[model samples]
Target chain A: MFVLASASKARQKLLDQIALRHKVIVSDFDETQLQEPDPILKVKLLAKGKADSALKKLIEENHALNTYQALLGCDSLFEFKGEIFEKPINKEQLISRWKRMSGQSGFLHTGHYLISLDNSKSDMESISQNNSCEGVVSTKIEFMNLSNFEINKYASTSEPYNCAGGFAIEGNGGLFIKKIDGCFSNVIGLSLPWLKNNLEKYGLSRLLLDR
Target chain B: MFVLASASKARQKLLDQIALRHKVIVSDFDETQLQEPDPILKVKLLAKGKADSALKKLIEENHALNTYQALLGCDSLFEFKGEIFEKPINKEQLISRWKRMSGQSGFLHTGHYLISLDNSKSDMESISQNNSCEGVVSTKIEFMNLSNFEINKYASTSEPYNCAGGFAIEGNGGLFIKKIDGCFSNVIGLSLPWLKNNLEKYGLSRLLLDR
Candidate 1:
């Protein structure tokens, strides 16, 4: 089994898609603790911090970490017009963002940090990036042009407010996207190919087949 | 409301994604009747035939298709190594195909046929391609190299046998795909953006907003 260090249902579904059994352990890391301007770097930092925070919690609880082979943390941010976007702040912001995003293209960057706990370390705090697998997967998305009426109508639905960049590709927003030009799974939340490669490259193929 | 003239659950889910109310009517067209060798043309013909057959059934049953504004038919085929692939014939075929397709790139084409019924004619038979909206959407898919064990294990599951290319992108196959470079929804079954454009451009914008 593996540990997922996030509260996102979308990320959890991604693991289910690949038949990976995982335990959801929400990280206590405050997302607002970082004010990084770079989208890629910000997501990577958040992903690592989330995993680290979860690890700290596991150790504190005296949890038997041996049951789990790996822990994965993920964070997604939409980069549009050189701005970082997570979930829209409010209805007005979501509507306004949709208006501006119409007929435009953006990049969705999802950072994945996977911690393999096979290596025994008496000093848990000694764990560092020296032996971690991580990456920032990005996908380009284009939105179809929308009129004011269309925008208002879609914004009236509750779907747009909860997703990054004010849209959910797998939900109602699927109709609005004109195209995507990269790893499609990254736009949803996790990059499956990236995860599969890391699982194999990090000597964790057991996770791939043991399911 | 619209009439979905196909039996694909994936296509039905695409309509649900956009909150479009649809009445699903299975077409009676015999798929084996099509001997078309060209992948693009074959899908287009199949899509149109499915829609036509459904329309004929509706008229025969004296069904009130007037309640529906449009009818959509969809067909998907995978083009790999200049060969058309629908579903793998059997486990051996699937394994062999996977072995040959490992680490290879191919195209997934989904043909969309939309028939607008608002501007109807006295004779339904008079309707021609000139008045209909259709297109074949294609997406490039790259597969990751798989060992023999991986192929055999994936084939053991019922997932790969039913998909067009011996893989389900939205299922366990999601891990096997390295990247895709086109309309993501098309790979699933329907092209949402293409449908959105046809709805708006062909003066069927009501389908988009009234949904």
Candidate 2:
């Protein structure tokens, strides 16, 4: 069994499509604590934090799941014009974000980490005898010129507030995107390709068989 | 009524999502006739050719629908390492293309033409008007590394053979994408935001709403 250290529906949906059996465990770390100019590093740190938190939680609860094989943690952020646009706080903030993003381009960065857990410390050391892998994937997005009315109408759906950059690429907000220059799933809040690649490192390619 | 000048399930699914009412008319133009180094130009030319072909067919058939306002034509191509990768010609070619793209970054260019059929009086005028509003939107895609076994497995599904660039960003191909850098729909063979923008320019926002 694998543990997913996130509450994002997009990430869960991606894992589900791949037919991976995973249990959801939301991380307890506060993302605002991490500060970095480079969006990639910030997201990577958050993913790492989530993984560590999940590991600690399982230990504290003395859960039998400690024998589980792996834990996956993920985090994403929207970077536009050299600034990071985190999740919005309110409708006005979402509207303002849309106004600023009108006819502009941006990057969506998703960081992923895979942590291997073993019941015995010796087993963990044996697996690490080779190499552990972790990485970040980024998707670029171009916004079409949007009018105030269109922006307001989309914002009213309240889908943008919970998503980074105040837009959910897979939902109603899809209409505002002029073009995408990278992985569509990354903007949806996870990178399925990246996950598949990492899973291969563990000799776990069987998970991808057509259902 | 709107006329769509192409037969692509991906594009059809997009229009359906937006609830746009339209009739599909497959183009009879020979795509191999065009020679262009720039992928953007290639797709735009193909799209325009398709629009022109559809228009001619409509006139020759003397279709009863009189007040059709807008006509849409679309084309897409896969670009990798400066080379344009059109749809795979055979199973072997499709497998090779999938192998090459298993863990690489690429771009998908989708061109759209929204022609105002009601405004076109003569064939010359129709061609001129079609050229004015046509544009290409490019979406970037990055794939994660896959082993030969995984590549062969995905290829066996035969999903990549019919798709431009040998992968469907919205279907099983989602497993291979690490991130997308532009419009998700563009990679799927349409650009909803671009379509919406063009529609709004003609005071046809109601088309989207009325759906």
Candidate 3:
């Protein structure tokens, strides 16, 4: 059995795509407290924090955390040039970001962390990053040169307020994406190919096979 | 106003992405009757036929066809090597196609035909393909090396029976697509960027901007 430690609908839909059986337990980790400036490291830390917090909650609930083969957590952020973007806090910020992102290629980095609690790990290394397997999937997204009218139309929608980069690739914003040079699923928030490859290392590929 | 001459949910969703208000009137054109072996020509004929049929129906119903700016029709086919794949006929065919497509790159060709009924064109040339601007948008899609288990699981579902190439990039099959090298929306059944560019030529981009 596998566990997903985030409550994102995109991630859940991804799991459904692969027919993976999993349960969602929202982690209460405060992502706003993360202060890392490097976008990649920041995403990795947030994913790890969410996974660790979820595992702790399971343990506290006497849920036999070791019974589950793996717990998966993921975090994603958008980076254009050198700046990182999460969800915009207001309509003004959202519009400002869209103006800058129009007609440009950006990188979407999604950090995935898998914590295996199979009762076979060394006691000292169980909770450390070294003990867990992690991977970061990146996809290049090229946006169309959108006019101000188009940009304002997209920014006026609520989809930009809850998604990284002030846009949702799976929603109305998909119209503005001209090209994608990497895993399409990564742009949607999770990288299925990366997740599949990582699961093989943990001998959990059978979960997908049997399903 | 624009008229969409197909009932495909994917195409409708794409139209909705840009907030374009349109009416869907399913065309009665028979695609299988096409004898053209060239995939590109076959798709173009199919799109044109659909648009022509829908326009005819609208005229029959006295829908004020001249008042509409454009009528749009689209048809897509997956070309792998030299063969054109529309929908897989059955589970066995779907599984066979997936086996051959595993880890391979193919092209998705979407033929878009816009029949402009704006008040500016001569009555005789308005409905002809020569007067109606058309385009073909092609996107290269790379599929993951799917396992037999994965292929069988996906083939068991009805998703493979209704879409070109027996898989949908916006659905479960997205898990197996590793990369895309052109417009992503083209793979989804329509190319928004291409549509936008073409609409500009017809002075119909105003439809989107004014919305």
Candidate 4:
């Protein structure tokens, strides 16, 4: 079995889409601790922190080697016009962000960190020394011009409140996306291509549990 | 209600994803009659044909005006190395196609056709003259290198059999897609932005049956 170190439902559904045998174990780490200035590095650092924190929990529970083969952590942030945009805190923020983002292009960066529990040693020091993989993928998303009414109506829906960049590409927000210029899944959450590549490299492709 | 004039489940789910209230009415159009050579035009003509056929069916049943607001038809084709690919005929063909497609990039073109039932005239002649919209969207898709075993394993599944380009970006085949360089939804079946644009233009954006 594999473990996902995040509580995002989109990420969980993405794993299920690929038929991967995985379970969600929300990381205990505080995401706000990372105030990294660089948009790309901010997500990367947060993902790494989440994975490490999850690993610490698994080790403490003495279930690292036997129950799960690996742990995956991912975080995404959007950069528009040299500004970092995380999830909007409220409807006003979301509406204001949409006003600025309408008819514009932005980059969404998703950082991925994976820890393999293949080492014979179960100690914390040994796992850190032995197995891990990291990568970041970005997708350029363009939105169509939106009128005030369209933006307000979209904000009224429950789709945008908790999602990164105030939009969910796989939900109602899909109607506003003009086009994407990179890994589509990366924009949604985790990059399936990136995940498959790493899983194959670690001889964990067998975990697909394809239905 | 909006009518979908094709048999593609992906397109239906796409409309649903955007909270659109639509119904499916698979066209009885003979797709093979069109021998169009241009990948872009091939899909466009087929989409138009399907919509026309479905309109004819609705007209015959005298249900076009009262039961639905519009009908949508879509068709997709993949262009790789100057050749057009529809669904593969068999497993051997699918495997061979993947071997050529692996580690390469290709274009997926999806054509969209919509017929608005806003006009009061119910006869076939009046409908053809008054309300229709057409467009085509394309996405450049790149594939990751796959070993023979991986290719064969994927081919053994039912995912590629009925899908255009011998792959489904929303399914297990997502593992093989490196990235897409255009509208991601078009690669699946319909272009959500395209549909939304046309719908909004015709004052039909209210079709969104948001839950």
Candidate topping lDDT: 4
Interface quality of candidate 4 as DockQ: 0.75
Which digits, one per residue and each the tens of the lDDT, describe model 4 over residues B54-99?
Answer: 8887878765366678789899999998899999999999999999
Regions of model 4 farther than 4 Å from truth: A62-64
Q: What is the TM-score of each candidate against the true structure?
A: 0.95, 0.77, 0.89, 0.96
lDDT of each residue in A131-201, candidate 3, tens digit only = 47888888999998988888888777778788888777777777788888898888888888887777877
How good is the docking of model 1, by CAPRI class?
A: medium
Q: What is candidate 1's lDDT per residue for B3-52, written digit by digit as tens?
A: 89988887888888887888999999999999999999999999999988
Error of 1 at B142 (Å): 1.3
Off by over 4 Å in 2: A16-68, A80-84, A117-140, A179-183, B16-42, B52-68, B79-84, B99-107, B117-132, B138-145, B177-184, B209-211
In model 1, the runs with Cα more than 4 Å from the true position are A119-121, A128-131, A209-211, B119-121, B127-131, B209-211
* lDDT, candidate 1, A80-187, per-residue tens: 989998998888888888888999999999999998876555566655355477899999999989888888888888777767888888888888888899898899
Candidate numbers, best TM-score first, in rank order: 4, 1, 3, 2
DockQ per candidate, 2 decimals: 0.73, 0.42, 0.55, 0.75
A85-203: candidate 4 lDDT, tens digit per residue: 99999999999999999999999999999888754455665674478889999999999899898899999988898788999988889888998998888998999999988988788
- Chain A vs. native, model 1, TM-score: 0.94
